[model samples]
Target: MLKKITLIFISLAIILTSLEAGTSKRKGTAGAEELRIPVGSRGVALGGGVVAEANGVDALFWNPAGASFVNKSAEAMFSHVSFIADLKVNYLAVIANFGGVGVFGLSLKSLDFGQIPLTTVDAPDGTGETFSPNYLTAALSYSRRMTDRIYVGANFKLISERILRESAVGFAVDIGLQYRLESGLRFGAVMKNVGGNMRFDGPDLEWGVVIPGSEPGAPVRSLRVPLQEFELPAAFELGFAYNLKVGEAHSLTLAGSFQNNNFTLDEYKGGLEYSFNNMLFLRLGYSYVNEADYIFNSPSFGVGLNIPLGGTLEASVEYTYRKVKFFNNNQFLTVRVAM
Candidate 1:
């Protein structure tokens, strides 16, 4: 299983790199549209520190390779995000261990736009009501420990989006690797959203150029043009984390990650998390990245609780909050269960 997963990711990496070879290597554009795809709530909280400490289903989003470290028989997680007005994002994931073979995970992320007032040029004359645009992503993931200190994983994803009445669909993949070093330090890398382009195939497609008048008896010819396809917001993230055991009951973790955004440019995020015997966790994180208009520099806070339920049951809840310039506060709530 590990060998197959590695081979698949290797091939995918080569293919994605080839497609992006000629494009301008410029980073964030004026309106970095695809940057809005929030990576993960837990990471967003700890400023994405999970790359090193990741475990359980959260690993599917942070660093799938970490899923191999999960000791639970089964694990599940669900998260909801109040990102902005009319925009809500939600995610659910589950991971199960298969004896001594490896671990498997399934995850889904959906962005919902509440109903909006549909308007047209003919407006009051009214054509039809506006429909909210929504996007969905479903992925299957696998993680394994090829060796004692090396871990790897891969994800196959299905993506679909609908705007008003038009829709488009595509597929993508994610690959990640993590290695632990001495002194409680960890290093990791991941490539995300690598895939082919998608074309909008909804209604309203017209044939041939509509000209006022060409000739007295000239017949208009139908012209077919290739669909306009957009590039995926592909990116690479490299991170490092170190944990300091202050005492028997207290520990502090500091982590930083650099993101090489394919569509945008680059970003830096740093954070710190403190834990009390793994029972209580408090995290503070900050991110810095240039934006077209306003710099999306913000700080995040999170709190977590780990409760042991009898024999094989475990429960946890995490809440994160971040303040973005010119936007309402972003809130994320996630619940996790293990057996």
Candidate 2:
């Protein structure tokens, strides 16, 4: 256990140094900002200090390793986030364990921009047409226990974004590890959104070109503008947690996490949770943003209910309220089923 703990710290130190070096000159270079939003109500309530304690289908958003130990056989979850600008995000994930071998999970996150009036240079505001923008990310994940106290996992994601006639498609991956001690202490680390550049190409960038006197009405050819590529907003995080248990009825947990972002400033998080009989839970958390680039979410609070059903099934429902900068507050709802 001592050796494993030491290794986890050493790995974190290395990653921190690497992240500092990689983000030193790439300040504002990343795109696809929607991918940075945290999913799952429990995670948001903990201010994203979920790397170590992520469980069930919720782990699909944070650390895939936790999914390996999720439930007894199968788990499914759905999440809804009401964000700023009347935007909403929806997530769904399912995980199934394969005996003592491993666990496989699948999830999707989707964003919709509702409807916007379509206007052109000729028609400024009365186009009478509307279009909705779409953004989606689909992932496949797998996790396994490497040792009695160590777990590892990976996730591969496909991202697609479209607006009118323009679209961008890209891919990314996540790698994570989790370590648990006999003393109820946990440690976790992960690297998220590691991918290459994404460039958009569509008919919107193509323009018809015509000579000054070429047939006086017909266009001669078309000119296309090249789109520049942008890097992904990769991030690295380290998390730690410990809990105090009173017999079998009441428990309290405290967690802390550090995030290193390539496209923005680093962040720190602290969270606390109290559960009664593992059925009712109350959570609170705070996030400290570096403010080097911009401000981020501030504080969050949540409540959760876990109920056992007949026929070896259990259900959990969670709700969270997060305070965002300029956006007031955002609400999240999540539901999970395990069997």
Candidate 3:
């Protein structure tokens, strides 16, 4: 136990040192911004502070280590988010637990931006054409119970983004660790979106340009503008949670987390949950950043219900609401099934 604890601290120190060294002054400059968006409704409702207690398929997007805590043999979840600026996010995840081997998970997240009229330098108003942008991420995850109290997990992700004829593809990884105590206390840490830079390239970046002072009737030279590569938004997070039993049928959980980002300000988050007989749940959460102009600083609210369909079969429905500063508020709905 002492060795395990020391190893955890050593790993944390290494990751923290690397993150500090990689910090950048340029904020909001990451390319794969979609990866930062929250997927599971439960985690979003918890203000992203549920890293320690997240479980089953819901953990695929938060802390993969928690995926090893699934009580069922298999679990699947589907979620939809009504995001700000009229955008929509859809997420799906499935996980299967093997008795002594490990747990494997697969997940996909996609963003939908409705068609928008194309515009150009010459046609500032409209170009009589419309295009839809596509952003998608697919991830494969593995988690194992390293010890009675230690859980470890990792996720390998493929990211793709396209706008018209230009497209960018990249890969990233997430590593997570969780430690649970018999006293209902949990600790978790995760590093997300660690990868190389991504650059856009396609036919749209190439065009024919004539030299200024060439010969008469000279052929036009094909010019291709080079695009700058952008780094991924990497973040390191640490969190803890305590589960308290109020009575035989009632319980409460309190969770808090601190997140440090490479390209943005650090954030602090806290969440509270009340549960009745493990069937009904109510949650309240809030997140704060040092920056005063952060858009998602408001409180979030959520509710959930779990029902047993039959022997070894269960279903859950959850919803969350978050207030946005300028744009419309964000809402999420999720359905999960386990057997």
**TM-scores, in order shown?**
0.84, 0.93, 0.96
lDDT of 1 at 64: 84
Rank order by lDDT, top first?
3, 2, 1
Winner on lDDT between 1 and 3 is: 3
lDDT of each: 0.75, 0.85, 0.90
User: Total backbone clashes of model 3?
Assistant: 0
lDDT of 1 at 122: 73
Question: Which candidate do you rate higher for TM-score, 1 or 2?
Answer: 2
Which runs of model 3 end up more than 4 angstroms from their true locations? 10-14, 21-25
lDDT of 1 by residue, 1-339 (tens): 447545754664565455442223454331214334564556788776556667668888877888887778899999988886647889989989985688999998887788777777678655566577778888899998777767888888888887765678888888888776557888677787778877776554546664577776677777654567876777777677888999899999888887766666467788898999888989999887765543458899989888999898989988889887777888889899999
Ranking by TM-score: 3, 2, 1
lDDT of 3 by residue, 1-339 (tens): 958775886788677766753333656677798999998778877888988889889998999999999779999999999898899999999999996799999999999999999999999999899999999999999999988889889999999999998999999999998898889999999999999899999998999988999989999999999999999989998899999998899999999898888888788888999999999999999988876678989899999999999999999999999998999999999999999
Alpha carbon lDDT at 181, candidate 1: 58
Q: Pairs clashing in candidate 3?
A: none
